[model samples]
Target: MVQNLNPATVQGREYLAIPGPSVVPDRVLRAMHRASPNIYEGALVEMTHELIPDLKRVARTEHDVAIYIGNGHAGWEAAMANVLAAGDEVLVPSSGRFGIGWADMAEGQGIRPRVLDFGSHAPWDMARIAQTLADDKTHQIKAVLAVHVDTSSSYRNDIPALRALLDDLKHPALLMADCIASMGCDRFEMDAWGVDVAITASQKGLMVPPGLAFVFFNDKAAAARAAQPRVSRYWDWAPRVDPDFYAAFFCGTAPTHHLYGLREALDMIHDEGMTRVWDRHAQLARTIWAACERWGSSGAFQMNVPDPHQRSHAVTSLRLQAPDGARLRAWVEAHLGLTLGIGLGMSTADDPKGEGFFRFGHMGHVNGQMIMGLLGGVQTGLTALNISHGSGAIEAAARVLAGR
Candidate 1:
């Protein structure tokens, strides 16, 4: 029989360091811990109205945002449904798991995804994308689905560059970016980057628990939706854009607690200011990367994306020998109360079972001490597991955090 585990039994505060569903702030939690409120009018309704503008500020867009009662995948389906019709060909420039997963979602939606697979380690090859778009003389590809940051591989792609490519090629395809992992962590300018449609979730850098998904679309993408044959009423953004009450924001009853949590989370983001939030995430990521570099020097580990310029501020994917990654992860969680992200797309010939990979998420509600503690825990795990790693990994990370 399984032993009953109580929260008090845990030694210390547990760290959730996965790429998403990141550590929620105490304020957000306090905001969420409330009885159901009046969903029709007054505070709840007015608070809901405030969310749109704040969300747009984070997305860096003046476009319309539609909130849905779902996860990131729901955002995917909603964005696809709004702008794509059955059998419409979409060009998916895949760099990692989420990229390919988006393509799979498109396939399920009765749309043909012409995926330009760029493997799991690197960003998209612009030349290939340019050639593909250039070769499509008939312009059958209606849209380009790009993942701004692939949390699986922790690789950041160039959305603005993709948009520039589209413009240079004079392609009429709409540029849709999946910013699920990067919205608040990394710098994403939807309107300035020329993105037609952008998708993100309340988790990740937004610092809210999973439940709400947001889809932001410009006038061009809205026009495309209007011209499309049909979009499921449930997924349609037209009505949700200007809902009369809270229930209308979602299809039915409002996600009362999540909305409350989201209001507080967005307030936190705005309070810090978006630029500082981006800088904080970036600095935290760099500190982690610096430590990982030291750890990798012993040949026992490696970073999936070696280039710092291409890596994501939200998460870092690391490759190790088979079972070392898994063992280290198990040890850290079991003994040190730290949770690391799974190596999402790193299954390889030598590393079957994907046991040789893990990720470190440094996004949302994370601070320097938390990151230092996380690294210290990992270093302890490495030593306890007898995992070969260079010395002074913690010191290296500290130096980075100290701006040395």
Candidate 2:
């Protein structure tokens, strides 16, 4: 028999504050409740036809977009498939677990990866990266991969600056970005930022389940793709963007439910307006950080991000008092029915120095009340555990949200 896995729901209100599989909008969830569609039918075909342009608008690129029935990792594979051949050289800047995973994927594909790591929190040294590109006289780097936001650390790197660096040095490397965290939550301009290829998943800012992955590419990347001698058919962007509805949207039978979910998601994004959505997220995130700062100054807590602007508007990492992080998180989950995010790439958790860190996700359907509820739960947990913390964190967050 299956075990009772989760704690009982919080008296009809359980909070899923984990970074991904973000709170789904009721409309989107309802959209997925219907039966599957005939892949070749009129509505499905017409819906498929309308999807690409909308998806492109979200990515801020008029270039090609491909959808796959997979997660963000598949998006990475597809982007790489279009651009890399066996033994091709690529430069990878890893700031966290996700970045390292991308480099490893490239390696598995027989692409030679030259890595420059910037830890889990900060962005790469721009001058150093520019010099590296300038120093590569042979132009051995076929592509340069960077993560726009490292979800694990809630770090948002400057993609525009990376593009500027490439332009300054006249680097021929095709620039790629993993915008999984920053896509809808954080402001990302693919064409404007000179991102030749970009990838993302559905679970984060897309407000959906973990079934869809999107890859966006530009003319330069397409041209480079044409030059690839060993592009995988399944991952090839050109084959997928066949100008026909069926081939363009799905190579095999469509992920009908996910398509429905995506359609609703897209509608919600466009209706709310992407710009306004991003601004709302930014406002909410600032409130969270403000609470963290107020708590940190009490000599009991601190935010993991060194700079406020660099911290992702989608997620925030908080370092709590000594050796109580894991315990406190467990207590919160058990008692309040709230799920907190783990520090994916951090070293010291529940340590003697009390460097335990946790992350809070404020992406997609999250809002002022959701954030307040989350912070309120954290405050409750801290008090119940008798953990030293400054009071009024929730109030600070409320004021931040209220524009006080």
Candidate 3:
């Protein structure tokens, strides 16, 4: 049994480290607290208008942006709807579970997926992508969907390099990105990367509650909109972005409260400036790697990805040897109500060796104290569970954050 728990707990407190539906900032939570306001009037409409350009700025695209009441999956379908017809083939670069699942979703929609499955933890090999695009002599591949950072495995990819590869091969396929895991936390230059379409959600790096998804698309993708045979209005991107009028962004009336929450979250991002937020995430990512390394050197624990540079700063997915891995996580949760992440869609080859790898999420409204808490919990939990790990992970992380 756990001991010495507090009722109110301390302020500037313990946080969710399992990623997505991240701890909504108190300001955002406050904004969402009231009953529904008139969808088309007062501050609601004003905030809606303000949100458009600001979202564009964060996406780094002058192109259109669509807001949906659904989650990231909705954004994915919206992006696909704008660019693909029922039978069109899409090239999907599968680096981890999410990418493959996304492709499967497209296939479910009657869009065929041509997969290029690379081993997990590696980026899309440009040569493999180029070769696949090159071999499409009939130019059947309609779009290439790339997941920027596969949250499940903590791997980041080079979209710009893939774009260059497509340009070099003269591949006619459009480039689409699933940035749900990395959008607000990682460096994403949509326009610069020449991405035709990209999708993200509020739950991860946006520091907002779930229930909102954004799809950004360039003219090339917008052009394809008129050509798609049938588009489910709710999941269609073009209409939502253009929205003849403001009400259309949310379809009929609105997910009124969600927009209120989103407005404050976006405001926070702006106040910090997106560039600085990206830098903060990058720095924190390095700190996480240092901590993981200190533990990994003991051989009792290991990171899923071998290369520090390749792993995500937003989420760290690591494998811990058991009978301690599961116990350590439960120990942390029971002791402090601090929940670590469970491995999701980790395949047969990976799961049999361990109970399930744990994940650390550092995205959205997170800072050093929270990260330190995460490491501290691990340090204590390892001791509680009698697992071996190097001490001073918290100090190493503090040193990194301090340097930043």
Taking all chains together, each candidate's TM-score versus the true structure is 0.97, 0.95, 0.94
lDDT of 3 by residue, 205-283 (tens): 8887888889998888877887777778777776676678767877787888888888888889999999999998988
Per-residue alpha-carbon lDDT of model 1 for 309-353, expressed as tens digits? 999999999988999999889888887789999998778887778
Q: Could you give me the TM-score of model 2 versus the true structure?
A: 0.95
Tell me which of candidates 1 and 2 scores higher on lDDT: 1
Candidate 1: 10-residue stretch with minimal lDDT: 1-10
The candidate scoring highest on lDDT is: 1
Tens digit of lDDT per residue, candidate 2, span 1-404?
21233455456767889788788889998999998777877798888779899889889888988889899989988899888888889998877778888999999988899889887756678877888898899999989999988888778888999899888888889999999988889999899899999999999999989899999999999999898777776787887887455754567888889889899999999999989989999999999888888777676587777798788999887777556677667878888888898766664534534337778989999888889989988887787777778878888888999899
Error of 2 at 362 (Å): 0.6
Each model's lDDT comes to 0.91, 0.84, 0.82
What is the full ranking by lDDT, best candidate first? 1, 2, 3
